[model samples]
Target: MSRVLVVDDEAGLRRALAINLSARGWDVTAAPDGATALEAAASTHPDVVLLDLGLPDLDGLDVIAGLRGWTDVPIIVLTARTSSADTVDALDAGADDYVTKPFAMDVLLARLRAAVRRGAAGEGGAPEVVEAGALRVDLARRTVTRHGEPVKLTPTEWHLLQVLVTRAGRLVTQTELLKEVWGPAYGRETNYLRVYVAQLRRKLEEAPAQPRHLITEPGMGYRFEL
Candidate 1:
């Protein structure tokens, strides 16, 4: 069974989630604060973590950065704070996904599945490097190359790539992309998306004006074909 760590101060919510997740066949673990959650994560090594932004002991962003310092274990932030800035902080800090409070269990399950798939794919990468025409991406090491030379990406750019690659070929909603890549604060900042898209095209696309992999869906969102 896949292991899952749930961190929330609300006793009822924590217990309910533990029971529900257990019913779904996950080995569930619970913590009431950030410090305990971190300990549980490091010691138990869960496949996915359900983190809450409002902790009794520490800032949620700190928890994300703290875990990132030691592991790539996927983190999904669960919070009542719907602000885009809150979402951006968590994502940029190293969270894999964000889910607002009063969320549906089915949607949460889907996010868990996505996180698990990405984590598994990260471990089972091909031995040799992969190329997008002249641009080469090292699947195993999470590095990129252009014309056989390494190409540097900003931290935000890398996170965006992670989201795109995880949902490749599917049209990820603009709000979802922004939440995944930038956080909740940027979910409505379509301008940020436009700027980042241009930046990514300039670096990854052969022609910045016409992109093949990074595609826009008009009023919808973006998708990475590869």
Candidate 2:
């Protein structure tokens, strides 16, 4: 069975998540604040972490940064703040995926399963090749080519691109990408997404300033048009 840590300041929520996850076959642990959540993250090493950004003590983003320094555990952030900036900030910080308040448990659980399964598999770990339009991605080689010419990509940038390409045409949430790519410690670094996305555009797109293939969803995350 997989271990899951649910971190939120609300006691009721913690209990609900613990009970619900337990019922679903996860070995669940709950924490009430960011500090304890970090401690539990290190100690419990949950396969996936469901994080709440509105902690009573430390800022969730800062905690996420701290966790990113050490571990690559999968992190899924929960927030009541629906601002694009909030989502972006959390994603940049290292969160794998983000969920808004008033979320449906069924949807959340589906997302949880996706995160767990993807995390365990490790995004971009495939040694297979992916071909999209003029783009050529060698998963085994971890290389990108356009129009038969090789393109250089940083480790992080390639990982980000892999996330977008794998979910081509789908609106992959900022949280899911962050958690899957950066790990569990980054549940609040949303700004990081813009930076890396910009990097990807610069490298992959013919016109970085006005991208055609990499499209943005206004207040949501980006998508690689297939």
Candidate 3:
């Protein structure tokens, strides 16, 4: 059975998640605040964590950092904040994924399963490298380089680029990119894509304002052109 630590201040949400997940065969542990969440995480050592950003004790990003300090366990942020800045902040703080508030149960479950699958995939994989123009992505190494020069990317930027480059020359729909990179609760978060895509263009494109590789389809989605 996979262990999951669900951290949210809302008693109703915690109970609902625990009951639903437990029914699905997950060993669910619930925490009402950041302190308890951290304690549960340290002791329970769950395979995944569903954390809320609005905690009474510690900010959700801090909890993410704390976990990252010792464990590679996947951390998914569950928050009501719809701002792209908040989403980026969570991802930059080491969160593997983010889910917005009032999310559907089935969507959240799918995200959890995806996170687990990714964690497993990372453990045993040969390097898969994708190239576009002068940019190179080492999928296994999770590193990107432009013109043989290493480019620093935040976790969010790397994930966005990873999805695009892996599907080079294909038009990746906005919803597909959001759900794949952020979480299932993010299909409509277009601003998140805008911010991260611009960041990626700045890092990987020779001309960000007039990008040649990362092409935007405007109202449709984006495509990676080699």
Candidate 4:
């Protein structure tokens, strides 16, 4: 049985999730606030975490960051925050998936399973290193270096770069990138692509205004050239 930690400020929702997940044979632990959530995660060592952004004690993004400092366990955000910025923020903080409020239980379960699968894949079977210009990306270590210096990237930014670098010189459509890096629910969120692409350019390119490696094909997609 897979262990899951459900973190939400709403007492009733926490109880409901616990009952439903228990019925499905998952070992469930629920927390009413971010601090408790973090504590439970450390003690229980769950396979996955269902986190709410609107916690009473601490924001969920911080919780995600905290967990990421120690673990890569899949984290799925469950919140009513529907704005693209919120979604991007959670992804950048290290959430593996996002589910809006009033989501279907079946859909959440499917996403949970997908998150687990991706987590497993992340552990094995990916190119070990990719080089583009002065930037060198170590996929297994999840680190980037430029001219022998470390280049810091948020979780979302790293995921975006990973997709493009793995498909170097190939046109990765905006829709495909949004779905693969963010989630299927974000296929239409082109603004996210724009923002993250700009961020990546500023970090990885010789000039942010005229990017060399991360190229945007007008109205279509992006391509990475090495």
Best by lDDT: 4
Residue 17 error, candidate 4, Å: 0.6
Give the lowest summed-lDDT range of ten residues in model 3. 118-127
- Per-residue lDDT over 1-226 for candidate 4, one digit per residue giving the tens place of the 0 to 100 score: 8889999999999999999989998899999999899999999998899999998889888999999999999888898975656766676567766778999999888877766665666677556898877899998899999998999999999999999877565456777799899998888899999999999999988889998899986655787877
Report the number of backbone clashes for model 4: 0
Name model 2 segments beyond 4 Å from true.
130-163, 166-217, 223-226
Please, what are the lDDT tens digits per residue for candidate 2 over residues 48-125? Answer: 888888899988898789789998777788899867787667766777777788899998897788777667656556
Number of the top TM-score candidate: 2
lDDT of each: 0.81, 0.81, 0.83, 0.85
CA displacement after TM-score superposition, residue 146 of candidate 3 (Å): 22
The residue-by-residue lDDT of candidate 1 on 20-50, one tens digit each, is 8899999999999999998999899999899
What are the runs in model 4 whose C-alpha is more than 4 Å off?
A: 125-226
RMSD of each candidate relative to the true structure:
7.9, 7.6, 10.2, 11.4
Tell me the number of clashing residue pairs for each predicted model. 8, 28, 0, 0
State the number of backbone clashes in model 3.
0
Of 1 and 4, which scores higher on TM-score?
Answer: 1
Residue 190, model 4: Cα distance from true site in angstroms: 6.5
What TM-score would every model get versus the actual structure? 0.64, 0.66, 0.61, 0.60
